[model samples]
Target: MEPILSVEHLSVSFTRYRRGLSRAELSAIRDLSLTVEPGQVAAVAGESGSGKSLLAHAILHILPRNAKAGGSILYDGAPLTPDRAAALRGREISLIPQGITYLDPLLTVGAQLRRGRTDPDTRSRCRKVLERYGLGAETEGLYPFQLSGGMARRVLIAAAVLDSPRLIVADEPTPGLDVKSARRVLGHFRELAEQGAGVLFITHDLKLALSVADKLVVLREGRTVDELPAADFRRGQGLTHPYTRALWQAMPEHRLW
Candidate 1:
C-alpha cells in the first residue's frame, strides 16, 4: 500500500543574528526521514529538543518566520507545498497540537469543532465524535479554560478526528494526562489507524510509542538513529545503534544494565 504521508530527508533550521549584522543558521532537524502508511501508527520517539515538534510543524508548513526547511514532504503522492498544506490541513490532514493553547480560548468547543459548518450532518458528527471520546454532548458548550487537562486532551483528539482526516499529525499529545488517560488516548490513535488513517505519533516517550505504534523511528539530536518494528524494540531484539540500545535499556520495564 502507498504511504499516506512520506517525509524524506527533512531538514529544518533557523536564522540567528549573532553579534553585529552577522547571521548564522542553527539547524534543528539535521536529517529526518519517515513514512506513515495508511492504517499505521508510526511513532517518532525521541528526547526533548530532539526536533520532534519541529518535524510536525515542518509537515504542516507552519514553521516560524525565521525558520528555514528543506527536503520533500509528500502527501497522498504529491508534493505538500504551503498552499497544498493549507488547503488539505483541516480536510484531508489534521493536527493534534502539543498544547491546549491550540484551542481558541474564546470559542466554545462546539463552534471550534464545527469549523464554520452549520449543516446538521456536521453538527451530528461533531457530537458523535465527542461522545466517542467519552465526552458528553454538553462538553461542547464549555470553553478551553473550563476543561481539565485530560478533558482538553480528549477535546483535541475529537477535534482532529472531526473531519475524518486521512493523515493525523499528533505532537506530544499526552503530556499532562494520567496513565489511564494516556492509555486511552493511545488507544484512540490505534483505533484511528485501524480505521485507515495514517497517524504520525510524535513524542519523547518510547514506552508509550511501543504501546501503540506499529513502526518506531528513534530520533536523537535531530537525526533518525534507528527505525524498526515496535516488536523488536519491545523485546530488545534488533536495536543496533548505541542510542537505540541505550533507550531500550533505559526503559523502566527493562532496567538490566
Candidate 2:
C-alpha cells in the first residue's frame, strides 16, 4: 500500500541569536525519514527535547519562518508546500498537541467542534466522538474551564477527528489521565486506525506505546536511533540500540511493582 504520509531526508534547524552576536544554527531534526501507512499507528518515543515535536511541526509546516527546513514531505503522493500544507492541516492531517491548552477558555466545547468546518451533522458526530472517549454530548455546552483534565483532553481529540482527517498526530495524548482513561484513549486510536486513518503518536510513555502502537520509532538527541515492531517490545526482547534500551528501562512498568 502507498504511504499516506512520507518524510524523506528531512532536517529542521533553528537560529539562536545572543545579544550583539552572530546567530548560531541548531538543528532540531537530523536527516529523519519515516512513513505512515494507512490503518497503522507509528509511535515516536524519546526524552524531552529529542525533537519529536519539531518533527511534527515541520510536517505540518508550522515551523518558525526563520527556521530552515531541508528535504521533502509528501502527503498522498503530493509534495507538501506551504499553501497546500495549510489546507491539509485539520482537513487531511490533524494534530493534538502535547497539552490540552489549544482549546479556547471562552468558547463552549460544542462551538469549538462546530468551528472545524463541520456540517449540519456536527452535533451528532461531536456527541459520538465524545462518547467514544467516555464523554457525553451534554458536556459540549460547558467551557474548557468547566471540564476536568481528562474531559478537556477528550474534547481536543474530538476536535481533531471532527472532520475525519486521513492522518492524526497526537503528542503526549495520555498525560494526566488515569490508566482506565488512558486505555480508553488508546482504544479510540485503535478504532481510528481500523477506520483507515494513519496515526503518528508522539509520547514518552513506553508502556502505552507498547500496548497501542503497531510500530515504534525511537529518537535521541534529534536523530532516529531505532525502529522496532510492537511484537518485539511485548516479548521483552532486549533492544539492540542503547538509547532504546534506556527508554525501555524508563517505562513505568519497569519502575513500578
Candidate 3:
C-alpha cells in the first residue's frame, strides 16, 4: 500500500538573536525522513529538545515564520507546501500538540470544535468523538476552564478528529493523565489505526510506545538513529544504535525512582 504521508530528506532550522549580536541559525531537524502507511502507527521517541516536535511542525507546515525548511513532504503523492499543506491539515492530516492550550479560553468546548472543523456536520461528529473518548455532553457544553485537565485533553483530541483526518500526528498525548486514562486514550488511537487512519504517535514514554506503536523511530540530535518493529520494542532487546540504547536506558522502567 502507498504511504499516507511521506517525508524525504526534510530539514528545518530556526534563527535566534541575542542582544547586540547578529542572528544565529539553530538546526532543529536534519535530513529526517519517514513514512506512515495507511492504518500504521509510527512512534517517534527521544529526549526533550531532540527535534521531535520540530519534525511534526515541519510536516504540517506550522513551523514559525523565522524558521527555514527544505526537502519534500508528500501527502498522497502530492508535494506539501505552505499553501497546499493548509488544505491538508485538519481535513487530511491533523496534529494534537503536547499541551492542551490549543483551545480558546472564551469559547465553549462545543463552539471551539465547530470553529476548527472543515465541514458543517462537525457538531454531531464532535459529540460522537467526545463520547467515544469517554467525555460527556456536559463536558462539551462547558468552557475550557470548566473542564478537568484530562477532559480538556479529550476536547482537543475531539477537535483534531472532528473531520476524520486520514493521518493523526499526536505529540505526548498521555502526559499528566493517570495510568487508566492514558491506557484509554492509547486504546482509542489503536481503534483509529485499525480503521485505516495512519497515526504518528510522538512520545517520550517508552512503555506507552511499546504498548501502542506498531513501529518505533528513535531520534537523536536531529537524526533518526533507530527504527524497529514494535515486537522488538516489547522484548527490551538491545538497540542497534548507541543513541537508541541510551534512550532505552533512560526510560522510566529502567530508572531507580
Return the top candidate by TM-score. Answer: 1
What digit string (tens of lDDT, one per residue) describes model 1 on residues 1-61?
9998999999999999998989998999998999889999999999899999999999999
Residue 196, candidate 2: Cα error in Å is 1.1
Q: Which is the winner by TM-score between candidate 1 and candidate 3?
A: 1
Show model 1 residue runs off by greater than 4 Å. Answer: none
Between candidates 2 and 3, the lDDT winner: 2
Query: What lDDT, from 0 to 1, does candidate 1 have?
Result: 0.90
- Per-residue lDDT of candidate 2, residues 1-257 (tens digit): 89888888789888999789988889888878788889999998888998888888888988888889999999888898999989888787999877788899989999888875456687788888888778877888999999998889888888888788899988888888888888887888888899999999989767778789998988777778888887777665867887777766666666656
Clashing pairs in 3: none
Q: Give the whole-model CA lDDT for all candidates, comma-separated.
A: 0.90, 0.84, 0.83
TM-score per model over all chains: 0.96, 0.90, 0.90
lDDT of 3 by residue, 1-257 (tens): 89888888888888899789988988888878888889988998877888888888988888889989988889888888789888878778899888888778999988888875646477678788888778887776799889889888878888887777889999888887778878887887888899999999998777788888899988777877788887776666856777767766777777667
**What does each candidate score in C-alpha RMSD?**
1.3, 2.4, 2.6
lDDT of 2: 0.84
